[model samples]
Target: MIKDEIFFKNREVAAYRLLDVLPIQQMKLEDWIVISSSFGGYSIAKIIADTLDAKLDIMFSDKIVAPSNDECDIAIVTEQEEVLIHEELVKCFDISLDYIYEQSKKNYENNILSLINDFRHGNPLENIKYKNVLIVDEGINTGLTMMACIKTAISLGAKSVSVATPILPSASVQTIESIADDLYYVEKLDHFIGIDFYYDTLEEIEFEDIKKINKGLN
Candidate 1:
């Protein structure tokens, strides 16, 4: 049973804890890249990337929600046009592939592309071909976003893909393990109460702050 208590005081605290388990010592640093799953993740990713001495980037991606339920994410899509649908959810709802594709295209062009332009000035993602990738997020809820990031990284020739997060739903552990090369997390809860519940000071990162972080990295 998972404990009923806050796991991290803040995202920075979680980042430091994750560094304890990440295999940074074995990595050459130059051969690895750190990618954030969201703008909020940049703070967490910055800490990890600084520790690993690796380049940091953001995965321009978004989730495709079901038509009837906005909370139900049916699939994930990246700016690179990579997609990963939740087959079980789609089947359970009898959702059509045509709808998924349509949503995927819309998400790519509308959401992901906007993020790429805002954060990266519309430049293509850094060359990660043959490089080990470590994807960081403050937390994972459905895991669809992270899964899509893994797929996109692999499709772009990432030699190996790993993930790091502060907390995740216990149910998602096995699925994430099967796809990524490694998973580093502080807590895996049997009953997830939402990512913010586990942190004492989880604030939404501002757009300007994220751009500042990007500039500092460059």
Candidate 2:
């Protein structure tokens, strides 16, 4: 078990260290696209985009069921949440919840693939080139999703693809290294229990909240 004090301390150190190593670029707002989900990753992406004076484009898997074919310069995705909160609502009255998890998982995977295809096809925000795309997630575990994002970016003719995650499992780092041109991670723990294990305030993002945020952004 990871000690809370030690974990947060290390995370703080890691965050600053990563910022130092991968300094935010002083680029125009038009040059960057921030694609993120409903949770912490979204918050982080927003901050990073602000630091770089880049345009922020928030994308949620739940809101935009289909991938975007718009032109964008950079794309960041908050790793989709694993826990299905909708299951709780169904189970409140003792509804069968077994299939919900499976279906949600399938939807998540499909959405990811679709987004990749959209990027590959040069469909990003209008006026944005969609080349030199960067994929940002909160954390990486197996690196499967990161690899998928990279492949999609490459197919879309992105000049380079970089991955930035706040934390990553050591094994996952190796897997990401094979495909990504550059990688920025805050922490490299050998026995990563879960991404939430490092954060002090981890909470579930409701689908309704996601919808509201997307609507606001639009």
Candidate 3:
């Protein structure tokens, strides 16, 4: 939020650069479990999980956008039902805390609950405990969701936590670094546009695709 960061022609350009920071042979695949934030993250996570042939899971997070500015994010709610507040932004924008909490609850009920059952396809989340967990997303604009995911992973007993993504805003990098054991990104910009800005094809991914992708792995 300090300043508008980097811009790319497209997401592929960002992903190509992300290659250097990706966790390849550095960690054992057997000891890793790949989990992703729903919707925006599925494609990136799908590729990573399939390539590594690692067990995959999904976690849902919904952001509370500013009342006036749709592009502005005020906070994030995780599937574990934890809420992360962007204190500075909220204060600067004079967003009501009560409103944030209400939205968080609504998002959890309408989004996260069914996502948990659908993503897991009936399996329990026992594999993440004591494992090197990698949380995937296409990019980090506000960084709130990633932070919540990192914290949730730790609470679930993740021994180490890492993040893999194509892009991250410069403002969010330090915040995410404080929480993630290892943070990886293809590009770090001073600011980022909407998630759709980086892609050519933005599709509404069906939940069934998540089940099919992780099938037989867990």
Candidate 4:
């Protein structure tokens, strides 16, 4: 039922469309630290941060996969290695939290940390304390990463949290609204598909791109 029609001609266009609805003009962008969900999530944050002249950071969070099922995400892991189990799902699927922790610890120690160093240039997370943080992604599929990012920011003493995306499911948007100070989006889709389905040309944002983006912050 979810057929793709070029809504805004990819992430750039989608970012602009979403921005028009956001109360960005009312805010001083310099007061925010725009946090990208990394790679695919960086597209929208780049435009918004550059237009508003805000500092940008990339989050290195990802999901913990269930054994033998790459698409079956059982838990969430943040940049700092905090693990959050999808409790209901874990119970329903008859999986143990211990297994989830093992997978998450492995993911954090192996994959996510390297990405954080490569994307954030080692310890770029220090300056975020007491700042307002905005988490940006092209779309929200499960909303777990955004949740983890929000919790991480709060733990790091971010005064407030906001989330911006071009597309999100209604349930995810509602969840985000409850937790974040603001939730901005252009579309709320049902029968939610992956973020890549919305675009015509989605490219991988490499370490060099992240470095270039971070360099602009200086």
Whose lDDT is greatest here? 1
RMSD values for the candidates in order, in angstroms, are 2.1, 10.9, 4.3, 2.3
Local error of candidate 3 at 123, Å? 5.3
Q: How much is the lDDT of residue 169 in candidate 1?
A: 98
Summarize candidate 3's per-residue lDDT along 1-218 as a digit string, tens digits: 32233344443454445555775766654578888866657656766766677777777778888989988889999877788899999999999999999999998888777776676644455468888888988787667788888988998899899998887678888888888888887767664566666555456667776566556664
Pairwise TM-score winner, candidates 1 and 3:
1
Q: Rate the local accuracy (lDDT) of all candidates.
A: 0.87, 0.51, 0.75, 0.78
Which runs in model 1 stand beyond 4 Å of their true positions? 1-4, 28-30
Q: What C-alpha lDDT, on a 0 to 100 scale, does residue 19 get in candidate 3?
A: 51
- For model 1, name the residue pairs that clash: none
Per-residue lDDT over 1-218 for candidate 1, one digit per residue giving the tens place of the 0 to 100 score: 24548888888899999888777788753588899988778899999888878899888777888999998999988879998999999999999999999999988887778877877788999889998999999999888888888889989999999999989999989999998999999889998878888888898887787888777675
Prediction 3 global C-alpha lDDT = 0.75
Model 2 C-alpha lDDT per residue in residues 99-191, reported as the tens digit of each score: 445544665566744553443232443222464555666666555445655654555466666777778888887767787777877678888
Supply every candidate's count of residue pairs whose N, Cα or C atoms clash at under 3 angstroms. 0, 9, 5, 0
- TM-scores of all candidate predictions against the true structure: 0.93, 0.58, 0.79, 0.89
Which candidate comes out best when scored by TM-score?
1
Considering only N, C-alpha and C atoms within 3 Å, which residue pairs clash in candidate 4? none
What 10-residue stretch in candidate 4 is worst by lDDT? 1-10
Off by over 4 Å in 4: 1-4, 124-126, 206-209, 212-216
